[model samples]
Target: MKKLLQIIIGLGFILTPFYTNAHVKWFTEVAPKKESIENILSPLFMGLALLAAVVLASLTIIIPKMAQMPLIKKWDDYLSGFRKYSRYLLKYGTAVALIIQVTNGTLFAPEFQLDSTLLTVLAWVTIGLLLVPHHIATKLGASILLILFIMVTVKHGIFYMLDYGFYVAIIGVLLVGSTKLENVGFPFLYLGTGLSLCWVAVEKWVYPTMSLDIVANHQVPTFGFEPAAFIVMAAFVEFVVGYLLVVGILNRVLGFVVTTIFILTTMLFGFTEIIGHFMIHIVLIIFIIEGVSFYNPPIKMHKTRVDQFIFIFLNFIFVLSTFVLIYYRFA
Candidate 1:
């Protein structure tokens, strides 16, 4: 047990820097460039990808066993105690994200700048509604957020706006609050946020040039790997994180590690990093609080150990390939 803990912690420390710097698009201006499918399917890429799949599959078996351990069970239960407050965290964290966006003259993301007075005022109004204590007020705020999202989609095109799809999930959570279906809100949040991260990770593979540019310009450390290879590893790390979130595996531990990584990156990326990732930070906190106690993840359906391992391994490969192909096709 002690050795296993040390290994996990060591891997986390090594991967932390890569995860922190993976949001290249947010920090750089390079346009997406299409790489040849052959280049993307290179031996090194496939090898690392297969290795990642095996590791994830192994974890699907290991994590459940780990959860039964006394210390881990206690920690999970302690975190679960805070689940009741998730709604408030989502509500005010969203309000804070809106305030940051409106004050900066942007919409949901830093790249989508507000271009008109009416839109700016509506953004503020949405923030005001979100701040109100009533459920109706929060729902109205979510409605306005949906409108703002649509407006930005109309201006920027759906492909560009898809990176911020988690906003729609946030809107869903707000609208469904205090209802019989409120239970579904957190699951949807996890799914939406997970898919968004996976989508962004695909961008790194599709447009390696952009990430390469960010690393070169920002002098991001590569830890002895060449910049291009480092980008590939980073993208894989991010994709695996998203996959874990979607599968509801290691919710609290994953949340704490990822949130810490994002916070550490602020030192390098500074204010822009915070503005771009504030909502994600909030979502991770909710993940820590919720900890998959109230929900049955897809992994729970497998019943047998071998079936569970196969399910995780195949699904990781399938999701990674599907995301890469779809993103590359659309790009």
Candidate 2:
């Protein structure tokens, strides 16, 4: 009954603003012709959002049960071996990158439509340096490259480089055989994700205009509710979710749920449509890593009723936000 009540409340939150439809203008995007709503919101985005909600809801319900199942526990043992394999793959990956660098420069030129620029050349050079007979020089070269890469990532806007920088850094770690460092990376990983998510929610809130416009012009509605209300709701939900994510509260479940939404987002927005599907794959990798963490659970994280309440509350908020956005756009 408690869970049912929570779901009901969440549905209500999602559905109420949907009836108002006062903020369709928020979703519009400026285009070459003019501000076309169609240009702002695509079917892919909408479908992805809906699909994410569904998948998250399912996972939230199922994963716990799976955790309890004897078969699932056995399966996790086999899955654990992948981490060791991942370490081996990382070493070989440098070789692959080396091959690609050579091929890209020699065979696939500008004529071949591959980017064979200075950075590509440098990347290959570093890879070769890592392969030398001298372990000290190899490790030193790789470490320097890793440091340079991190410096570049931090110096630039976190949002601009975060996605790609994260992938590169992860690859570097794997290549260098830093499994021990995974312990150190865990807290920072949580901190970074939490901060990013919180910031995203805040950005949408502050610039409700951009996010809301995307909703309106794209023809995604808020269950017939006024646009302003929906925008407010969205801002609030994102803020709350972001806060929770950053603080590392309810991280496991939230991580799973958020990943689902991100996956849907990639499918709808076009991995290549936004920044390229590469980031999407990176996100998937992050999700997998998180799943592995949960399975092995190097650290023990205890849950409280407060955590459950927050999860249910946030879920409710998104449900209402979605329903409202849809109702206004359609009905």
Candidate 3:
């Protein structure tokens, strides 16, 4: 019962008020209805499902037990050592994110492309200030970020931009939070990134044909499942991992898993995956190093194996429920 309550500790629905008939109509108009669920879930999908089950079990069971082994303890200690450089790592990472936004011609989204040279120049200027050491620069950076946020929110609409706008908001949090709270920034970044991933995951569910098409063209291995089922399972994994990231539960282990997945994807897809996910690679490296920041620790972390298992399982359910509610309401 205590653990169930703990699941909701930091879980808050950030309602996007931009839910209107127009947006609903837009999504429904474009959503693909050709795929069948049973057709997608084949022998391969079951195999992948079994692997996912093992991973879930390992997180709650084997991982906690492995932590007691000497080899794993040394690894934990080594990772803990990187916490000292977390701030510097995050600051520079912000710069790379901004550069990627410009280079990609999109703020990480194809729809929200910044077309104007003037706005691009301004964004780069603010990005430059972020790298500078002057204390006043932080406030100036925050001002520019606020201006950009308003521009995006006004031009793109909150609902439209909410999918990837969180990245921009993360930059704002760092600049504003540095000058004031000195702490609010990273937590917001962590949350924003998680939400961004989950939001993108929903796209697969909404437009399964697009992903299935990609799968067909690429001949991507489905671990024995049909293309549609693999795509759906991929969405679930992305959403669940994103949820785990926000709640700060077994995040380091998940970080490794996601990183490995991305690397393997690069091997399979070749250069396109590399170019598309470059900034994400940077973010994953940061999470891999930092684990979860201690800045937003409301849930009392448990040490015992049983307590850890309950905590992880509940967080998974929390994210799963959130995803279902959001999908039904928005998608």
Report the number of the highest-TM-score candidate. 1
Cα lDDT listed for each candidate: 0.81, 0.42, 0.58
Query: In the order shown, what is each candidate's alpha-carbon RMSD?
Result: 5.9, 13.7, 10.3
What TM-score do all the candidates reach, one by one? Answer: 0.92, 0.47, 0.72
Q: Which stretches of candidate 3 lie over 4 Å from their true place?
A: 1-62, 165-169, 176-180, 267-276, 293-315
Q: Model 1, range 178-234, lDDT digits (tens) per residue?
A: 899998998998888888899988888888998988888888888999998998998
Better of 1 and 3 by TM-score: 1
At residue 69, give the lDDT of candidate 1. 88
How well is each residue in 1-331 modelled by candidate 3, as lDDT tens digits? 4532332241111111111101111222244553444543446544654555445535656644666889766776777776555555555555655676677675443345687886787778877887886646755765776677677778877655666545564565556544566566667767777777777666666557667666666566789987767777887777666665665554566677776665555544443333345545556666776666454542347766566556656555555556645654554
Candidate order (TM-score): 1, 3, 2
Q: How many steric clashes between backbone atoms does each model show?
A: 0, 46, 3
Residue runs of model 2 more than 4 Å from their true location after superposition: 1-66, 69-81, 85-176, 179-182, 220-257, 271-277, 289-331
| Top candidate by lDDT | 1
Lowest-sum lDDT 10-residue window in model 2: 17-26
> How much is 239 displaced in model 2, in angstroms?
5.5
Q: Could you tell me the lDDT of residue 109 within candidate 3?
A: 38
